[model samples]
Target: MKKKNDENVLATNRQARHNYEIEDTIEAGIELQGTEIKSVRAGKINLRDGYVSIKNGQANLSNVHISEYKQGNIYNHDPLRVRRLLLHKKELKRLAKEVDQDGMTIVPLKVYLKHGFAKVLIGVAKGKKNYDKRESLKQKELKRELQRNFKLNQF
Candidate 1:
């Protein structure tokens, strides 16, 4: 049997990293319904446009898309429904305070299954300027070029 410590990533928000500079990350459980979990396990989830919102001291996930389970008839869940995130009181308070700061927001980084439960990795991030995005792209290209050159030299 596989160990529960192993994590199976379902979906990742690649745009989040490019658009926002993540400062800190936290792992929180997702309150998924029966059909929702089925869809998630099938890797039919999209976190690209998803974000986290703290309301009334609770964290809610919005805009995340989990496709309906084909086998589910009337039991299918809404693809774009707002789901509740499970977090500790202290963690929720900290996230709320951080979001209250100007330019700081919470974003869903990735969704995965851990220990038979769905978990989301949320990040505290600030929007990056266009210049910053360009610089990052340049850095990535440079790194790729360096790796290619190194590989050629090894042959």
Candidate 2:
């Protein structure tokens, strides 16, 4: 049986939008142990403080917390271990080049199950300045107010 979208989930980092401007996205496979996979299936993962770093020419996800499976007494995975992200050589090289540029970063946007396999959505982003963030907030508020006025006029 398949789990519902809302169920069998762990955690999500919603703060990515507030901190950075996402430029592009890529899906990468997460290398997991059997116990860790089970724990992820049960929705015991956290990607809030998670980040991807290049080490020895490879990408590794750090600070991503995958909680220990309750049923696995002896073979449970560590909750805060670094997990490898699978990507093609070409993609890896591209990401590496982009990250080498100033203000560019790699952020894991979301972790979800696809076709019974766990997948992560990673975004290449640039940090937004304080003025940029404030402008975005102002635009959002103006849009909301316009919507509200439109709805009131309709009624």
> Which predicted model would earn the best lDDT?
1
- What are the lDDT scores of the predictions, listed in order? 0.94, 0.87
lDDT (Cα, tens digit) per residue for candidate 2, span 37-105? 888877788888889998787889999999999999998888999999999999999999999999999
Those runs of model 2 whose alpha carbons end farther than 4 Å from true positions after fitting are 1-11
**Alpha-carbon lDDT of model 2:** 0.87
* TM-score for each candidate, following the candidate numbering: 0.94, 0.88
Per-residue C-alpha lDDT of model 1 across residues 79-138, encoded as one tens digit per residue: 999999999999999999999999999999988888788899999999999999999999
Report clash pairs, candidate 1.
none
Q: Give the root-mean-square deviation of each candidate in angstroms.
A: 2.3, 3.0
